[model samples]
Target: MEKNHEFIRYVLPKGKTFSGLTQAQATLIANHINSTARASLNGCTPFELALLLLDRKLLELCHMAWIPADQVTLKPTLLK
Candidate 1:
């Protein structure tokens, strides 16, 4: 929730509206965010945590995939 919204706000340009975002753009943002390492997770990314704790079928249903560390992009330009 709040954290997810905050991440989205941080990744999008100022004054940009969510309605203008395409599905592909949204998925890219989500993938990048999940792929990023977090201190709260003890350096593990959300994607890694999910892989360890969640069912593979559920993840597949959600279209989630592991983004390589070197390939993860957190910048607003990710949507561009």
Candidate 2:
């Protein structure tokens, strides 16, 4: 959580204040940061990293449960 707060502060434009910021503006800033390439991701965006991790997690769960492909339908809403 501390890292996230630091990231929010770093991404906010110079001379801008977070005070009274609207939800839309806050989301725009967050999306911008998440999409920007980072050295830690070897030039991949965080969203890409998240999707890769999510896929691995889903596969792991399916294996653990011995779930048959025909018995399960992993819908897009499951990601949310």
Candidate 3:
């Protein structure tokens, strides 16, 4: 909810109505924002942050004693 409000206040033109946006337009706008860097993320975009988190999780799993050592070579397919 707060993210939506921030988008409206900063991204949308003055006096523009949210209802005026088409579904595709709204999604495009949202994707653009998520891909853009923000100060709150210390200059990383939300997408980058998510990928970083995923990488950390993968590392942690690979370090687990029960996990096969060969599995450490596996990488996240989507992010690449």
State how far residue 14 of model 2 sits from its true place (Å): 5.3
For model 1, the superposed segments whose C-alpha errors exceed 4 Å read 1-3
lDDT of each: 0.82, 0.51, 0.50
Cα RMSD of all models vs. native, in order, equals 1.7, 13.0, 13.9
**Residue 56's lDDT in candidate 2:** 56
List, residue by residue over 1-80, the lDDT tens digit for candidate 1. Answer: 46667788788856978898887788778887898888888999999999999998998887787889998876677776
Candidate 1's TM-score: 0.82
* Candidate 2 structure lDDT: 0.51
Q: TM-scores for all candidates?
A: 0.82, 0.49, 0.48
User: Which pairs clash in the backbone of model 3?
Assistant: none
Record all residue pairs in model 1 with backbone atoms less than 3 Å apart, i.e. clashing.
none
What is candidate 2's lDDT per residue for 1-80, written digit by digit as tens? 45456666665545657686766555545554555556777977665676667675763443322223243222222212
Clashes per candidate, residues 3 or more apart or on different chains: 0, 0, 0
Find the number of clashing residue pairs for candidate 1. 0
The prediction achieving the highest lDDT against the true structure is 1
